[model samples]
Target: MAYQQQQHYQTQQPMPTMGMQVGGGNRNAAGKPLDSNGKREWSHGLCGCFEECGTCCYACWCPCIVHGKNKQRINHLAAKGSPDPDGGACCSGSCWGHCLLTSFLGAGWILQCINRGETRGRYGIEGGGCGDCCTSLCCHSCDLVQVSREIELEEKSFGQRY
Candidate 1:
């Protein structure tokens, strides 16, 4: 009886196929599958800023909040997991100094902008309809909403790529 049960279990196991999607999973959610050039494109264009009304409005009115949230989400996705998810030094332990810099130097946006570049790198998304620094500096609200949308829409199936 033991030998028979062992054989039954062994035969019941599912076989792993090469490149076969196991369960209606999408490996190409980030736009088209990798081309011969080996790059994946963003599912949505940067100019599609108004695609998400809530994100656009939030980014417009509360730029800092939008940037902070985008930074956190990007960090989480890029690192698989990150302790400093907010990308804020205060939250990561250096409270007073970071607070001072934010208040006086006004450099908090730099971290968020860096994360935007990181997100572009991860998905091979192109930059420079206006360029990263200019987009982050001049049209920050639009850039924030666009980045948030890209991550939200495209990252749904990203983990399975591994």
Candidate 2:
């Protein structure tokens, strides 16, 4: 009876083969496969802003422009091949909003935090809301550049897929 029971239990369990997508296979919005934990690190670190001097300068001098461009890219990716609702404009409402908020309320970090969180979630980036808020509040310019680089990398990878 014990031998028969062991055979039955072993037959009921099937092992996953190599390259098999177990648990329906987790993927990010860009359709990239994720690890077992369903998370990945950022392509660039916050302090690596100098890696892209032009982008770093742009973000430092005119953050609104970089913010707008980043938003447009994210929207384009989210929309896949569809038309972007923001019309892919660099000076869209989001950019203006960031500018106005920073110019007046000095609370532009709020919008930055929101955008960062959204980007992290879409890319399955390993981060939490608290970290996002702190990064946006403390290293505003670096955060923008980091996100810009990440979106650019994602676009490159996504483009190759099709």
Candidate 3:
């Protein structure tokens, strides 16, 4: 019996590269593209708070209202879908509870500080001016006003852009 020798050749194929995009091109938490103008990407300078009289007044008198509104917006943006049924209640309760609790005891800046930290964490903002708590403690109203402005502007920009 004679066995015939057979040779098999293997063909090489190039592997496909992932080609993942970097920097994600400035996407929001919901994976949506932010406005190219970048108007809503970051907070305005804290010193500019007085330039917007309306925001300053609102933040001054009823920080809870501003904070609650900002919180709601942030939550909404993060959710990026049907609004949460308990969104209003949760925001109201948390804002009121924290604001009242912090204020009555002369520590009103605490909540703002925490919220500032949260904003920074969400938006990838760098901390500045002796840390969140100190910055908020020193410029509590400005912080609240600035945060409110940022979220409001961002939501509006989102609507306009998409």
Candidate 4:
């Protein structure tokens, strides 16, 4: 039965595939997962122990998505001023402070939805609001804020089409 228990434990304890879990088995009532260590590293909706840490920040990965090339350049730039970028007295244990770029591309989903003169949270929110729903579903039911229907279009080059 020891072998069976070990195998069961292995399957029950999934590891991080994209980001870190921060803490152990402190799952929510809905079993949404927890960050017992409170490292706040955010996950890719995976429920695993704190040990299987993920490098990418699922919640605040703006820098990764927007500045993909810049990130590679930063990493490729042969070592830096310090043995580790975030090691000074002013620095925390993590290099998050050293990233010289913004993370998420969107300011806020709610703001974008409002600015677009729309309702419903169709676009996924990055931080406070906004997300990736193509339909204008996020703005209609909102009562706290209202946006006018008139909107101006900004023209851009071919590269900005996407």
**Highest lDDT scorer:** 2
Encode model 1's per-residue lDDT on 1-162: one tens digit a residue: 455544444457677342444333332354466655555666666667788888788677656666666666656555553223343322332233333454688664554467678767755565543477777767666777777766664345544322
Give, for candidate 2, the lowest lDDT window spanning 10 residues: 21-30
Model 1 clash count equals 1
lDDT of candidate model 2 versus the reference? 0.75
**Residue 120 lDDT in model 2?**
89
TM-score for candidate 3, please give it: 0.63
Mark the regions of model 3 whose C-alpha exceeds 4 Å error after superposition.
Answer: 1-42, 81-91, 128-130, 160-162
Query: What's the TM-score of every candidate structure?
Result: 0.58, 0.72, 0.63, 0.14
Per-residue error (Å), model 4, residue 27: 38
| Alpha carbon deviation, residue 96, candidate 1 (Å) | 12
- Name the better of 2 and 4 by TM-score: 2
What stretches of model 1 exceed 4 Å from their correct place?
Answer: 1-30, 33-36, 81-109, 128-130, 158-162
In model 1, where is the ten-residue run with the lowest total lDDT?
Answer: 87-96
Ranked by TM-score, the better of candidates 1 and 2 is 2
Best-matching candidate per TM-score: 2
Residue-level lDDT tens digits of model 3 in 42-159: 5578887898898698777876776676677567666663232343333576578667766678676777777787776655566653578886778777887777665554454434
What order do you get sorting by lDDT, best first?
Answer: 2, 3, 1, 4
